[model samples]
Target: MSRQRVVLSLISFLLSFISFSQVTTEVDTTKIRIGEQINYKIKVEADSTVLVVFPEGQTFTPLEAVEALKIDTTKKDSKFKLSRIYKLTQFDSGSYTIPRQKIIIGEKPFYTDSLRVDVGTVEVDTTKQKLYDIKPIIEVEKSSSNWWIWLLVILAALALIGFLLWWFVWREKPLTEEEEIALLPPYDRAKLALKKLDNSQYLIRSEVKEYYSELTMIIRKYLDEKVYERSLESTTDELINRLQLLKEGNQFPFSKETLHNLETILKRADLVKFAKSAPDTALIEMDRATIEKEIESVKAVLPEPTEEEKLLDQQYKEAQERKKKRTKVIITVASLVLLLVATYVGFGLKYGFKYVNDTILRDESKELLEGEWIKSAYGYPPVYIETPEVLKRVQDTLSDESKDKIKQRVFVFDDAEHLDIKIITDEVDGGEQGQEDIQRRVVQSIEKIIEEWETKNVQNIITKDDQFITPNNVEGSKTHGTADFPIKGSDETFEGEYAIFSFATKEGMIAHVTLVWAKEDSYAVDIAERIMNSIEMKSDEQANAEQESQN
Candidate 1:
């Protein structure tokens, strides 16, 4: 009787343990179509205060968990029932199993039973489907909205050119009055000034002071031109002293009477002009007549120019002409350089230093950026983008057996030395596949690209991949790497950089952009970046419109 009581006590303890650790799992269906959702539920019953945790992530292989739904909780007397649900799907048609899921309740873990699922493919009636050949290459025109920018640039450039031409070539600069006077012979210049003074009515206007000033200037100028170098600039006493010394030294031929008369007239004119002393008009006339006669006398007695002096004067005139020419040349060159610098600065500020360096240094990438860029739709679900050059369509020549499985269109711009860009769009037969199948297709495309690189003798390849998203929030995958390629007909090799962007559209179109270029070509990289930034996948309506237009 005691043994039977112990057995009953042990049974009660086992039942209590089972009630405390209750956990179960169930699925709404065991079979589903590819990409069809399956509801998986886990239930746990424990004390009201016990905390329970459910398994997370893609722990269920072959069946991917799309979402972990909110946990539902219910209280029953003194116990709490917690339930967690997950939405699961399979991309490929196959038999799969959701492994046991662990549930933790207050530090102790319990597991739910495993479940099996069957994924079936959607059947397509090929007889009712229509097959179309790849569309012909459509040439897209460059954008014209930014024409005003180019127009302004051209205008600024023309203005700079015109300014340089005016400064250097087309402009006619006039000589100054002093320069014109300097061009005349000294004697002729002095005589011309005296004649001009005579034509003036200074004396007739009752201007005795003016008359004396003119009279003295005429005499001093004549003396300066014919005999004394400093006569025009020196005072009356200094001029007389210089003349006396010249005459005494026999350096110049001058009569004592002539010197005395000249000195007297100059002193009288200075006193009349500076001291405001009134002079008779008759005295001024007499002084003018005497000055004219003295000038003639001096001219008659002047020594003739020697061969050496004549040669020196000729050489001096030639030197002056050469100097003027040099000055003009310098001015022209300086103006041209200034205009060039101004133009460079204007464009540099508008574009950037990279643009300036690329243009001036003849960088290939810079040329592409500055050149005309075409915008176009390529493939079935068209990819919209801008490129430096128009992409040409390559004929698709896949075998007949595989053609029904996939349709692809390719466009390319290949400049073997600098850049190679290829755009591809593919439409696979299946549309209901999951993320894994999409990812697998992308990987296959990347591998194909790498294989093509191998055919081109590309070596030392280094690759990396990451998730990418477009400006429109469309998600994609990006694979980028570097490699070395052997130059054609040479043993030498050059470094090349490459990038591949793969995207699966909502309409089941798979599109990719593949770009490759010499690593030294910075402008090519810039072009690639611009094209990538401008990329957009066309919607169904837009794609249909494009096709209609092409048709």
Candidate 2:
């Protein structure tokens, strides 16, 4: 019984100790403002080490992050204790739920109830649960992007206003004649411009082309606009020639040295501009100085006249006048020659007898060479060819003119497509010794040969002239306003004033022609070919038909 009592007592003591060792937790406050840390303490008198798990979003919203997660360790005799301190804040101003969290004490689970936080706009007790927040910066941004631009715009507007105000005042106030004259820049302004050039630091740095260009222009423009009124835009050579009329001297504004230097610069510039040459720096620099001095040398003085100078001036004026007159005369003569050759050449010689310019000649073309034959612009005009010269080479070559009967044919044509022809003069004129004589002689010779021949016409020779005639009677031949013309080929009486003349029809065919007449004296083969080649008979139907039949 004693032993039993001892064991029971021991068991009771062990139970008391174990029950007392269970861990329990208590919180100082259930909720607090942001940054006011709440004290949560866990009291335990346990035998083994304890581990705790903290809630994630339940403890703090992600955006309202934990500032600090600190572990506090303390020792009590031989026991180890661990506690966590979380420093947390919320950027949001709202009531939020802290979700219930689990705490395990040796596998016995305990859960804390959900807590609400009230963050207010006030200072709080930090020793307790205090809320502290950084105050917003109180500064007002002073914008340079704003008032500065506005001020600048205002300043510009004010400046423009001021300018306009001043301009209106000045402009509205009328100037007396003398005052106006005073306002006019003096003639010495040219001198001032040159002085500025001489003193310019821009020149020393050798901005050569610029310096020379400026210098030359000032002086040249002064001459062009004020003195001679000539276009200095002209070539340097032209400018010099113009100024050469003024006179030569130191006082000439264009002194010899200055003129020469200006000439050199202009010429060098021309070489660069036209000849495509690039000048060396040294030459450019020298030219710059030369121009500067030239510009400076245009002083206020008059050029003097001398007897020799006056004579030369007069002579030059006369020469220029004569040249102008000569040019006009040459142009006139050229135009006349052009008109004269226009019709014969199928274009005016004046471009090919652009006789379209002459009203009279346009109306009556034959009037061009109606007078007695004389040497003309055309070489050896109205040249006559003897019958013997026409046949000189062909004389022996001719099949004895006696192949029984001499068959000669004349077909006048405008186109070379067929044996087509045109008749300019189908009547006969008896020969005499006058303008009429030469013409009739040229006509009758052709008619006599065809008229007396036993003529044959194989096809209808298309004579294009309105007046076509059979190569028959002299006075009785078909003439004008009718188509009586025939293509003649045959034997006998090969003589008289019938000839052919060929022309360029410009109708996609070789020649425009007229069956004409000249005397028994024959013309050159060139003349004969001229007539024959002019007549292009249509493609021979008989021959073409034969070809088709053969095919």
Q: Candidate 2 residues 375-402, lDDT tens each?
A: 1111001111211111111111115332
Task: Report the Cα lDDT for candidate 1.
Answer: 0.79
Per-candidate Cα lDDT values, in order, are 0.79, 0.45
In angstroms, give how far residue 37 of model 2 lies from its true place.
Answer: 4.0
RMSD of each: 16.3, 53.7
On lDDT, the leading prediction is: 1
Which parts of model 1 are misplaced by more than 4 Å? Answer: 1-183, 204-207, 248-251, 273-276, 349-354, 375-386, 390-420, 423-477, 480-499, 503-512, 516-526, 533-551
Task: Identify the leading candidate in terms of TM-score.
Answer: 1
TM-score of each: 0.53, 0.21
Candidate 1 per-residue lDDT, tens place, 370-415, comes to 7888788777556787888889999764677755566778899875
Which residues of candidate 2, in runs, are more than 4 Å off?
1-21, 26-36, 43-45, 48-68, 87-100, 105-108, 112-551
